[model samples]
Target: MDVTSQLEWHPLLRDPTGRRTVKPRTRGQTMVIDKGLGLHAFEDLLQTSAPYIDLLKIGFGTTPLYPTGLLKRKIELARQHQIAIMPGGTFLEVAVSRHTVPEYFDMIGLLGFTAIEVSDGTIEMERTVRNELIRLSREAGLTVYTEYGKKLWGSTIDAEELVETVLLDVQHGAALVTIEARESGAGVGIFDANGECRDEELLDIVGKLPEPDLLLWEAPQKQQQVHLLKTLGSGVNLGNISPNDIFSLESLRRGLRSDTFGLELSP
Candidate 1:
């Protein structure tokens, strides 16, 4: 039952874009948001699409709700597949609000999480606090992925401020900074109220970033995914992907889907 040992059809067809990298990739990373999938469903996801996933986030304040054994097993499974697993940033924000950051980091280490998301989607976080959190996460032996922007409806990106955040975050050892596009993928970050991408705004942000690959755009909807892929090239890092869309998103990245059929991904 070792899926990794099995032959893949990809070799036969040859990805049309010819730029998709294997797992443990530095770019083109796909981060899946697990709202609350049971053990079997989680395992099934890894068995089938582990190759396409780089980060597995146990979505928003739902980690503590799972039975301890189940949560640990899920983390173990993800580690076995070489996927970095972490609790969602919202949960961490709760810890921050309660002034229980020590307890949070302790529990995260005990639970076997390999990563941490430093974000302030719903809370107010100063740059100093954010930098310390990123430093703390690294000190705890965890990979840091920071998120920028608010989760409120209609929140949009400020190109100048975002560039500053990304620069400082990387300087502080963040692996990638994610743009917030809540699970709804509407009226947040680069997307408009209709979940359509505001191309000009998105481009402006990208144009300002010194390292675009250091960002992970949260595009949960298929249309949003297609738009980002087309606009940013197929190698852009993406986050907040739903579990069901793993293979579908991979298809889009490979130019195997109609929307991105002729897209050329960067090598």
Candidate 2:
């Protein structure tokens, strides 16, 4: 199995400008959120774009829906490629709401998710509990990634609040902090009702934030993706990408797409 020798592998278009991230990277990380993928489809995604994808999130509560065998297969495949696969944070929230946080950890650890999202998107979690969950997930041997923002429509970010949360999450052992744009990427946290990026809001946060690479912007729309790529450079970490768009997004990052063609590669 000579990987990177396959005819399908293309040379990166940018010559000296080529600086795509390597595995176990902190920046330029692309996360593909899987929402109930069947075994065959999941296999196809990894076989094709495993090189570009750093994380695979079993979206929302779909974690409980897949058969145990299929779920284990996905985890093993992802790990084989050095990709982290975790159940969505909302499922953890569900467990917390139902007083099943310990049970959630038991199931998640046993089920083979190497990462966990400690988020409070729908429910208002207590700060102490949130920190405890972060610590517990790490204790249970999962890469803890926390998210900030509500899932409600038209919800916008408070720059100061976001900065504080980002600092605390990183300090508490979060690998990264995901900005909540939901799966739709509309009417929430920098996205308008039409799924457009709110430049004013995004710019303000970016300006105030200390370490931009620690933030993974959830830009599910192509237009939004292009805008972020152009504004923040290819090294910006992005999330909530659909399975089919993995190569497309990677193309955009490498300036191989029409939207990014002739755009100067980031140094």
Candidate 3:
């Protein structure tokens, strides 16, 4: 039904944050994680919300779990909608740990994925190894997005290390650097055990980033999303969003909800 074209709100009550840039958007980008959605569900998601999603991640080593055909179809569907699709960084980390990087790239290519996530969350990766992986992914014609921070419980971003990592990653041609807040969004990265954002640490990391907009915060919780949107501006890039929350998050970004109503107003 041409969802992107048909979906619209009344003109008078325009988005308070202004018109959202359509697909190929640089900012105000939302990246959603797909743990395991069936074909129908996947299609429905794109039908209803593709325009709001810039990236779709097949979460955490689940790529191989899907039947080869299904995985290929999912990748194809996302690209058809102009969305960059990739397996979660954990899958690539597995490739690194096993020394099967060539196979990894070949498989991703065979599956028709449009992007790759380079992360060191679960394993130790040397800077040289990381840079080469990013470069190789780009050489494979995949958009590279790298992730920072660990996957351990209570992991925190080191301000100095984060600045170094982001700079190095971008220099190697990464599309964006994601801060690793695991799916739980609790006890990891910027969020605490209770899924509450550690404001001081968040501020410290942001202050150190030379290009803050190139960072993608993995804020899976609604409260966390609201806080980041308020603090980072409506145009902030966010990742790890659940499929159900796409519309809800869009509403928040546009200041349509009570939590963010009049947020973009000059008052």
* Index of the highest-TM-score prediction: 1
Instruction: List the global CA lDDT of all models.
Output: 0.93, 0.88, 0.91
Clash tally, candidates in order: 0, 0, 0
TM-score winner between 1 and 2, please give it. Answer: 1
- Per-candidate alpha-carbon RMSD to the true structure: 2.6, 2.5, 2.9
Quote the lDDT for 112 in model 1: 99
- Distance from true position, residue 141, model 3, in Å? 0.5
TM-score of 3: 0.94
Among all windows of 10 consecutive residues in model 2, the one with the lowest summed lDDT is 8-17
* Ranking of predictions according to TM-score: 1, 3, 2
TM-scores vs. true structure, each candidate: 0.95, 0.94, 0.94
Q: Model 3: which ten-residue window has the lowest total lDDT?
A: 258-267
Candidate 2: residue 260 lDDT (0-100): 81
- Is candidate 1 or 3 superior in TM-score? 1
lDDT of 1 by residue, 1-267 (tens): 988787676662668877778978998999999998999999899999999999999999998999999999999999999999999999999999999999999999999999999999999998999999999999999999999999999899999999999999999999999999999999899999999999898889988877899999999999999988888889999999999999999999988889988788852
